[model samples]
Target chain A: MQTMVETRNLRKTYSRPDGSTIEAVKGVNLEIQQGEIFSLLGPNGAGKTTTISMISGLVEPTEGDATIGGFSITKQSMEAKRLMGFVPQEIALYPELSARQNLAFFGRMYGMGGKALRRRVDELLEFVDLADRQNDRIDTFSGGMKRRVNIAAGLLNSPPLVYMDEPTVGIDPQNRRRVLDTVKLLRDEHNMTVLYTTHLMEEAQELSDRVAIMDHGEIIAMGTQDELTQQVGEEDRLEFTIGAQEIAEAVFERIQGETPGVTRILFNPPEQLDEDSSVFAPALLTVFAKRGRTALPQILQELDSAGVEIQSVAVREPDLEAVFLALTGRALRD
Target chain B: MRSILTIILNDLQIFFSQRGNLPGLLVIPVLLTLVVGWSIGQIGGGGPTRLRVDLIDLDQSGMSAQLIEDLRAANDTLVLCPLDNDAEDFCRLDDEPLPLERAIERARTGRTSALIVIPAGYATALENFERVVIDYYSLSDPLQPGLVLQSLNAVLQRASTASMIPGVAGALLDNVISAAQLPPLEGETRDGFLRALYLRSQQLLTERPSPVSFRVADSDGSSGSVLDNGFSQSAPGMGSLYVMFTVLGGMSVLLRERRQWTLQRLMALPITRAQILGAKIGVYFTLGIVQYAIVFAVGAAVGMEFGSSPIAFLAVMAAFVLCITALTFALAPWIKSEGQANGLVLLLSLSLAPLGGAWWPLEIVPEFMQTIGHISPVAWAMDAFHDLILYNGGFRDVLPEVGVLLATAAVLFAVGIRGFRYE
Candidate 1:
């Protein structure tokens, strides 16, 4: 497949009010191919938005360039932008205008006009299932409705490549499912390239053709789901919810030594709920095993002999969450 | 360019569509223009009219009485206090006897436009061709011509010319008698001839234009247009005030646009930053022009003169609007919230409007204050408007004012474009 988007050592440095500098995106590089749904997964404040902002020409890179369809975003921004569309995280539409008016205005901004602009606006309203409410003011719409119209606005010019930055944020489950389906349709039916940024692991797992795990301004891992999950060596993860008191180091060593197929055991201490409360949240004990379901009975017997109280437990999962944990020694959210 | 215009049209549509903005743009300003336009007429006449002059006739002779009558004829607007009494004590006297000392104080304090005091022996001194004294007192600036003083001067000049005519005629008769070696003529014939000569001279002087004629001229020595029912004062004055209110209001809208991220979204399009900035500027400029147009339309209805050059009138309006639009952009980036921007709009519009002589002529303010009033761009605009509306100036007369406005606009545009936040 032809490369649809490329960035070379893209960096962004912001100056603080007190004259200090913080590097938000440091010398990052990426290549997204045509017709691929590439996802950048990272927790909040991980610089995923910043990198995508530079690539979309919404922000000027401190150093480096992004090329879209053989056009440099920095040097040939107009041409680069002509072949792309952007749906920012915010609802980014005029609240006073009707949904149709907002779509028509943005369509004109992308150089469409007259009947063509009107037709495209009508088509997008239908595509988003908002044709009935197209003439209603955007401010009067629900959060989900606004998000739908926002997506419709971004696709006004029918660009080949589109960037969606957390398009489903702050919406209900139904809207999230709909947004996911919309992304699938973009690639499956239209053969369009998509650069999607999200913090949710489930969203990446369900929609991405390729995934890049970003943390603190750098890409830590990249590849298909199968190729990436293999890094954890096929060990199904086991989770144990215990009482407030955690097992001691000796107990942990004993469990790892005696339990067959148990590769590693990790214990987390209880966490205080708040300053006003004496209640502490339950501690957690995670044990990774090759055959986690077969090994669960032995792991429980070891904990029972040590006089430990277990609240609940889960058997197995070798997914992106496990991959992120294995690679960074922390959960995706952490 | 089409994109720029499209953006401008969109913004204007948004601005006009809001129901809350109508009063400021249309209803309030038009009503204020009518109020201000008529209020000035109440203070004075339709234009520059009557000034009160207090006269004390100490001589009480025919000559002094004649001087008083001549003063009235010289300028009908000079209403002599006490002699020409009315219910309104325009002379500022509290019905007290106007002793010479009290009258002097009135002139000194500007309670009256001026005071003319004739000495007790003025008529006798004038007839004998001896030195005559007339005390003229006022608090008016000597540099600016005082109309009351001119009226008094014309009366005094006629009196002096009358006194000299007799002396010159008497000398000429004596010279003719000596040269011809003839007997002396009778005193009756000689006195009658001199008296006849004085009467004819007075008639000729009266027939000619008075030295104190109220024909106002420009600094360039051109005749001026008269004010029509005070619209000259109110039309441009209120027009400028409303222009500030309308244009500075853009600050809040610009801030709201940024907060809503509509401005940021525009940057993601194929449009250039220059186009966006140009369109934003154009929106405010067009609104300002429309604001002026509305008020001036009322002015036209009320029969206000726009001087000789409509083109210069338009140039003044356009330049002023551009300067204000630039001002709106230059200050927009510093505003953190829509409320702050709204507060700033009110503060600037109200304060700058009055400071720049939109409420009244800067000439009425103190000299130092007039200099400071120019700090507001409205002052430059008002100056240009005054040149055209009040002074009957053409395009050339307003160039300096228009140039200042445009130059200021360019500087502000540089600052605004440099500091404008797109995201």
Candidate 2:
């Protein structure tokens, strides 16, 4: 597989009033393959825009080098830029001009003209689902419609590599879904390589072929979903409250028998549930079913006979949000 | 290049699509021309002040009354308002010697153009060839002050000649002087001698005579059409004043293109940042030309003669527009907000027009102001236009103005290129 974009030890330092410097991007080394969708996930102020700007040739990196489609970002800027398209976090469109006109203008800047230019403009408008509103002025458009047009303009020249920074931000759910589906179509139909950045964990997981989790300007983890989760090992996280050592032992056996691949089970009691064997009551049966609750008198009777009286129950598993929390130690938005 | 054409098409589209902007851009210039044209005709080169004349007769005699009637018969250009007063009632807007102080004050305040005081026996003076010792008063602004004096002079000349005609003069001088040397003979020759003598002298002139003539012309004419003169000069100055609007509007392209992310997106494309800047500058320069054409049309419709040489006016206006266009591109990139651009445009427009002689003619302004006017492009443009229109100057007269404007445009273009940014 060919590397469409590669960053080698890229570092950016910003000086502060105290004469100290901030390392916004510290020695970031990455490679993205052609035709692959890559997502970079980070919270606010995590140097996302700065990194993207360097890659897109909008900002000059203080150190290291990036190559886009074999063109060096610093040394061959025009070529690098020519190979890529950028959609910024903020929606950028001319409010005074019609949507179609905006696309046509940008297309022409890339040396497009005549019938070819017109065809490209039409295709982009249709691609973004803005064909019907092509004649409407952007100022008259809804926020979502404007954003779609912004995306369409970015695609006017049909560059093979694309960078989208928070493309779904501030959009309604229906529009968001449409934009996401369109992105999928771009990848599936055009074989376009995309570098998608967002703080939304679910979106990143859904869209990215390879996810890179960055925090405080540093990528702490990067891999496929399974590969990254596997770093946490056989960790289908399990937990239950227990009132007695005897009941805890019995609950452990039940969990071991019910769920395959169950490796380690731990019994812990909350400070408030002390001396109550009923704490492991309902939870003991849940382990066997692996469901929140099984509405059955038989199960309840069995738990009572087994001396596992119900008080409280809780179970945990390793999902994307959990994995992210484990790595960053904070919520994605923060 | 292609981008330039696209940008022009975009501007034209917006201009046509947006009805509100069209009225101010196109309709107002036409309307200004029509309104100002009609008004100029009504005022007749003077602006808009009517003529007022006051006759103060101290001679309550029949001849003095006849003199007043002749004064009233002249024409509509002069409004003869008669004032009567005792010495005690002098300052009351009525009465005669017309109170020297009151009459002077009334003329100064524009209540009367001139006061005709029939001094004690001003009629008797005419009867004796002692001279009709009439007193006159007038203010300074009227270009027609001479007209006022001329009318009063005509009335007095007629009255004096009337008192001297036929037997009236012959009866008094009949015993003392010969009849062959006497001026003329007529019936009530006292009544019409003045009118006939004035008429006969008018007929013998080798030169075509104006309605009123004197040995020495009055330097101050009547204040007939003051605003007309002001508006003519003011309209051209407004050309300079409103040029800033184009500059402001041109600079708006930066924020607009930047906001649209067009700049950023363009940079990402195969093009250079310079290409984008070139396109915008090209577009706004075109806008500046459009603005100049509109203002020129307005000035022309108002009957402001730019000059016999159309090339000179076009060259000067083109140079000025280019300089402003370059200035717009240079300054626009540095300004971060639309409000700041607006404030700069307004401040520059207001201050530059006055300095450049748009508010009034530099001839009436002080020498120091005239020198200062050279600092603004508008000043150069006005000088060039003045040479062309007022002086009827040829292309050579406008060459220096064009040179300076071109230099300014070049400098601004260099500076603008230096300041441009892509994101």
Candidate 3:
């Protein structure tokens, strides 16, 4: 397989008004192959956007460079940009313009014009299932419809590479599922390379052929699902929901020492949960162990002896979330 | 180039698609031009209001009478006071004399717009081919001479030329006859010859058209004269004022585009940043031109003068619109929110429009205020338009104003394009 996109030590630093500087992306290196879905999976503010912005040529990198189809993004930006499509996280389309108009305009920007541009727009609109609403202003459409049109605009040039920066954000579950399927269709049917960025581990897990797990402006892990899950040594995850109360750290230490197969444990206090909910979320305690089901009762007894009220418990197989938790020592949502 | 045009067309389509932009772009500007033009026309009484001019002809000779008649013919709007003043009354020897002091006082008290005093040379000075000084008095400021005074000056110019030419020619003839050592003609022969020459010269002068004629047409297609109407002022005035309104409104639109990330998306395309910036500027500039065209079309329908130079008129419109569009871009990068941009647009348009004499002529303002008003680009544009519309001026007459507007636009575009925030 040929590499469709590559970045070498890409970095971006932003300067503040008071003269302080922040390194948003720290030496990101990526190689995406043709006809594959490569995911940059991280929580918000993990340099996913800055890295993507550099690769997409929307932002100037303070250091290093990226290439799309071997065309340097910083030097041969027009040629590189012509080889890819960009679907920004924002709706991006003019709200007052109809879907067809927006698509045609962007199509012209990519050097497509006349009947060819019109035909491409029509095909993309139909592909996005928005042919009926193609003439309606984007402002008049629902969020999902607008998102679909936004995605369609990116596909106007029929480029072999596309960058979708959290394309499923702020949409209903059904629409999100549809977007995921569309992303899959692009790779499976059209033989196009996709660089997908998302905060949701499930999305990355379902869509990505290879995932680069990012945190704090650095990619800490990159591998397939099985390769990443194996890094934590086949440890099952044991989760406990406890009523909101102060639990001593010594209790977790005691459980780790006494349990035979337990590897490590992490606790998410209730304060870290959503503030808007009327019902209080229970404090969570996650324990990684070989055969965590055998260690669950022991962990529960240890918590009960410490006067911790147990609300519920769940034991799960290792996944991306567990991989992130094992590597970062924090929950993916945290 | 094609991408730039596509962006402009795209923006125009978006602007027209929204119904809210119509009132600002077309309706209000047209209605304001009409209402303001008609209202100002009413202030000048619709037709040409006759100027009250008091004439004290101390000479009371046939020459002075001809001067007065010529003044009346020069401007039909001038109404000469004192219908029956002869040499006795003019020389202050009549039983009930209207003295020069009283005539001067009438002019001072605004009873007359100007007063003309032809001194008591009594025709002797012109007969001898000597210079004579006519004492002219009026309360009109020299800086802003009144219409009556202008008309008086015009008539006086013809009178001086008509009288002087004959006197000079007769003097030269006498000097030539004497210097040639010919026989010197006696009093009646010389007088008869000079009188014949004077009469014939006056006849020729009268036969010819007045050197300067005022042809005031009813430009509005109404019974009233065009001089009294304000369409010439209001068309460009309100047009420029609303051009600022419509173009400066781009600041908010630009901010919204940035916030919504459409600008970012455009940057992500295969186009250069300069192309995007040029296209954005072209969008607002084209809209500004369209706004001016709509207002001026209404003006044309209602009879407004576009002056002798159509190309200069277009240049003025283009330069002013470009300046305002540059202003929009220069300020757009600093605006934090749409509400701030909106408030700034209203504040700028309202303050700059009135300050630049968009609502009234700059001539009505004080000299210092006029100097200050030119700081607004609209003032330069209005100055150019006034030269074109009011003075029937050509391209050379408006070049200075156009140069100022273009220079200002260049400076502003430099700042705007330099500081423009693509993100």
Candidate 4:
């Protein structure tokens, strides 16, 4: 496959008023192939947006360069920008203008005009399922509707590559599903390369052909789901959702020592609620074992005799969540 | 270039769609233009503007009344306060009697141009061949007297001339009688003849134009009496004032675009940053022109003459609008919020407009004020406008003013382009 997007030591730094500097994206490198869905998954403030912004030519890279279809973003910005469409996380449409007007205006900016521009705008509106409400102002539309229109705007030129920066943020579950399906369609039917950034691990697990997990402005891991999970070894993860009562350390020690095929055991206490409230976040106890299904009954009997209140229990396989936890000693959400 | 035009069209469409902008753009400015124009009253409103002079006829004698009539004939621009037909109190004095002290105070304070006191026994003093004094009170400059003082002097000089004529003629008659060895004529007959002679001389002097009776005209030889109500002043004056208001308003809108992230989105487009900046500048410049056109149309409706070259007029308008638009951009980057932008707009517009004499003619102010007024771009624009509309000047005459405006615009555009924030 041909390379659709590539970066060489891409970095960005910003200065504060007191002459202090912050490195937002640190010496990052990435290569995305044509006709594939690539996702950068991380928590908030992990330089996901910053990396995307640098690639889209919205911001200048401090130390290195990125290329869109081999066009350098800094030197040949106009050409690079022409080859890709950028969907910002915010609703970038003019609120006072109707959906159709906003689309037409952006289309004109892309050097498309006359009847061709109008027809393309019409098609995008229909594709977004907002054809009936095209004449309504964007301010009057719901959040999901505006998100759909925003996606349509980026698709106006139909370039070979598209970058969507959290397009499903602040939307309903149904709209999120629709947006995910739309991303799949872009790769499946249109054969267009997509660079999608999101914090939701589930989103990355579902849509991405390949994923790069970033943290603190660095990519911690990258590969297909199976390949990334293989790094943590073959061990089934057993999760026990427990109550506010703390499990004795001896009980955890006994589970790993006495239970056969059990490799390691971990416990995460629930976060403290306010003093006045009776409720608290449930704690979690995870156990990794070679044959987790064979060891589940023995673990439950141990917990019951130790006076531990088990709210729920589940037996799982080694996945991205488990891989993240094993590699960094932190949960994916952390 | 096409992208620039497209952005300009889109922004302008958004500006006009908002109902809140109409009053500032059209209604308030037009109404204020008409109101301020009518209040000026001088040129062609069909309402004659004349200096008010309060006269106290202490003599209440026939000669005093005659002297009053002569003063009127001396200068038509003077509207003597409290005339016999002043039923409407044209002097703005409510029905109270005008005292000599009060009239003197009025003249001293410049509330009235001047006051004239016709002393008692003015006819007896002239008839007896005695010297008499007529009192004049005014705040007019001593070295360069205004119309009121000049008219008073001319009328008084004629009165002195009339008074001396009889005495000189009497002395000559006596010399001729003695030399020819003939009897002297009767006193009553001589007195009657001299009286008739004095009246004839006074009539002749009053009938002729007073020394201050000349009409005002422009250097370009245009009729000074060219009929334009105050619209010539008010139209361009208010137009420039509101141009600042309308164009500087873009600062807030630019801030809004940034806050809404549309500006960032536009920067992400294939177009260059310069094109986006140019389009934004064009938006405000176009709005400024629209504002000027509205006021000028009202001026035209009232028959205000736009001097010899319409192209010069257009150039002045364009240069001024561009300067103001550049000013808007130069200040937009420092704006932190919509409220701050709004406050800056009002502060700059209000201060700059009046400082440059948008409310009235700069000529009416002091020499030092006129010099200081040039600190405002509106002053230069108003100067060019006055040359074109009032002086009947051509493009060459107003080029210096236009050049200054464009130069200021160039400087501001430099700073603005350097400091403009896209995100």
Residue A229 alpha-carbon offset, candidate 2, angstroms: 2.8
Mark the regions of model 1 whose C-alpha exceeds 4 Å error after superposition: A239-258, A264-286, A295-316, B45-230
Candidate 1 clash total? 0
lDDT (tens digit, per residue) of candidate 2 on B124-232 = 5655546556777665344545556766667666655555553344465444445457654455754465445433432332133333433322214343334334345
Candidate closer to the true structure by TM-score (higher is better), 2 or 3: 3
What lDDT tens digits, residue by residue, belong to model 4 across residues B206-261?
Answer: 67766544233222323333336377778998999999999999999999998887
What alpha-carbon RMSD in Å does predicted model 1 have with respect to the real structure? Answer: 11.2
Pick the winner on DockQ between candidates 1 and 2. Answer: 1
Residue B120 lDDT, candidate 1, scale 0-100: 98
- Which sections of candidate 3 miss by over 4 Å? A272-282, B45-125, B128-150, B153-223, B226-228
- The candidate with the higher TM-score, 3 or 4, is 3
Question: Model 3, B1-423: lDDT tens per residue?
Answer: 999998899889889978999999988999999988887665542322345567888898988888787777777766676653344222122244457887787566444556788888836776556677876677658777666667667877776666677678777887988899888777988778877777777788778877865533334445344433477778888999899999999998988888999999999999999999999999999999999999999989887768667898899999999999989988988899989998999999999988898888776678789789999998999878876665445576678888998888898889999999886
All candidates: TM-score: 0.78, 0.64, 0.80, 0.74
- Candidate 4: give the clashing pairs: none
Model number with the top lDDT: 4
DockQ of each model vs. true complex: 0.57, 0.38, 0.68, 0.61
lDDT of 1 by residue, A48-79 (tens): 99998899887899999999999999999999
> What is the TM-score (0 to 1) of candidate 1?
0.78
Model 4, residue B292: distance off in Å is 1.7
lDDT of 2 at B299: 63
Model 2: per-residue Cα lDDT at residue A100: 86
lDDT of 1 by residue, B22-60 (tens): 999899888988887676655543343456678999999
* Residue A121 shift from truth in candidate 3, angstroms: 2.1
